[model samples]
Target: MARDSLIRHYAYLVRVVVGRLVPGGKSRLEVDDLVGSGIAGLIRAVDTYDPAREVKFETYATANIRGAVLEAIRNEDFLPRSIRDRLRAFDRASLATEVRIGRPATDHELANELGVTEEHVGRLRIAAVASRVGSLDDSTSGSEGDTLRFGDMVADPSVDLDRELQDNEVREALTNALGHLPERERTVVGLYYTENLTFLEIGRVLGISESRAYQLHGQALSRLRQRFRPMLMAA
Candidate 1:
């Protein structure tokens, strides 16, 4: 197939793969930008394709396209180092608490363990969320005796809702928590996660500085964490 034909035919695959990785429709990258990056991957795959390996072109192309998209996302990570370190500390603390408890730890429990106030813990969680970028790719978690994976939820996709909604209790809790956020916080959440906009883009859209966008994101996450500690901790 000609390069142009290949691009046209497989272009949708890029959207599918990238869309899944950045689900919630809240990506800073536009669809056209992602597609263009995938096109670059497709061209590279075509030029270096190895037919002698007996590999299917579709499989090879899919890997290349997803990698290209993820690479582009990685290049755009702009969180400060201090924020990253803080996020890491919070993650570590949460993991430690979970290991000891064999279940999700409440904010109070985590606060006690970390020797911080509950408010501080909530702030840390929000900060962690602000600093991190979620991935649609598979991830493994859970206690040592029982491992769970984001991919495992798909064993019964119709019922599991991809593990995101598997726990009815958590889902309801999350919805309630989201509903209680301030209007601006809700908007930031929708724009950042649902629209996939970057902080700068979100700032521009909301007529705020980038720092303000970051603050709102953190504040929203903090508020949600305060209300949904059980659900958040379990996940």
Candidate 2:
């Protein structure tokens, strides 16, 4: 009964972890699948947790849940070989452009370098980010059957602030990275992560196509990931 009660009480945590890991429903894996994996992780946390560790259960369980979801995603070879080849080609072209120009390459530059159209590059960028981390749009179902955007949940004050505060270093690094982004890229990040706008909505706000918005988001994330790599690895 205690285990079952623990699972029941912490079930919402599974959804939270799933929402954070796979923000948009763009992954080949469904939200339900990731939620199932997260629940398994939560159950494991409940079984293995140590009261004397001086760590909060929520924090410990969060790590476990994230790991489980990531593991589930990794176990699936979801991308086609053709897409994988394109992703590799895009990466090579991006690096070459960066080296040649002494700066991160824009999507247009990379497309030209790779002998592909800008739209092709845009899709590749979207695929690149999606393969690593899910998209920034879309919503997941909350524990009570209500739709909840992860961004909104993050902004909600009722969520545990202490858990958030524990990641001050990462948060600070991200803020600094965002400040360094180009104006347009920064706007896309804010609108996507803060305003919780889908790429289509962001496009309308910025007077661009939805695909262009995705390209900007992907570029912003690539830069942020480069900056955050060290901190994230240590974390």
Candidate 3:
């Protein structure tokens, strides 16, 4: 089959796959970029796929497309230079502290060694997390295996680049909003969303009721959405 036909037929598959891979906040990899990568993977699949084989083309192409996109993400270090440097320093300090204590260092212990406040350490952890791009196969909440890919959520063919720029704005807004959350709410948000814990698990971790965990989670998201609403409207 010609590549063009394959692309037209399988384009929706790319979006489906990419949607699962998209994260909630600001991300360096856009849905369109992932779709483009999927196209490249599809073309490669077309060239190499064999009809005589029992394997379905969609299955074959999906893996190729996902692999291509993941490869692109893995090749890039999207974190800003200063944050990257700080994370590296943190790692070194952690290892040294752990070796000295014969145990894993607490965040505060590592913070003291690194000559920074515990709060600074916490911010660095969040910044490092915000900068990472995860694999498509990683399981997400709500939609079965589908992750948080927002390709379908913000579909504006006429303003893709503008939307992409807005993604950055949204990320900045989220980072700032997170800072304003009450300490417990912020911790709950981080544990439930960022760490992918269940509400029950989060409650257990925090020694609170599961319903309370749910409440904190809801409040955190409400605050974040409210904080980012202006940026979303402008975008």
Best by TM-score: 2
Name the weakest run of 10 consecutive residues (lDDT summed) in model 1: 152-161
Cα miss at 198, model 3 (Å)?
Answer: 11
**How would you encode candidate 3's per-residue C-alpha lDDT over 1-235 as one tens digit per residue?**
5678777888777776555445433243565676788778778877877666555677666655654554444344433445445545654565446435544456588679988887665554433233332122222233223234233222211112233334443356456777999999999867755576776788889999877886786676556555544332221
What tens-digit string does per-residue lDDT give for candidate 1 at 1-235?
8877877887777766654544333435454677778778777777766777555677666656655654554345454445445544555565445434544466687788778887776565443332222322112111122122223211211111333244444345446667899999889877765565776787899999877876887677566545544323322
In Å, residue 151's CA in model 1 sits off its true spot by: 4.5
Candidates in order: C-alpha RMSD to true structure: 14.9, 14.8, 15.6
Clash pairs detected, candidate 3: 19-149, 20-147, 22-149
Which candidate number would show the highest lDDT if scored against the true structure? 2
**lDDT (C-alpha, whole model) for all candidates:** 0.54, 0.59, 0.55
Instruction: Sort by lDDT, best first.
Output: 2, 3, 1
Q: Please, what are the lDDT tens digits per residue for candidate 2 over residues 121-180? A: 555544444444322332221122233332432321111323332444424544676799
Task: Itemize residue pairs with steric clashes in candidate 2.
Answer: none
* Two-way lDDT contest, 1 vs 2, winner: 2
After TM-score superposition, the amount by which residue 117's alpha carbon in candidate 3 deviates from its true location, in angstroms, is 44
Candidate 2 least-lDDT 10 residues: 152-161
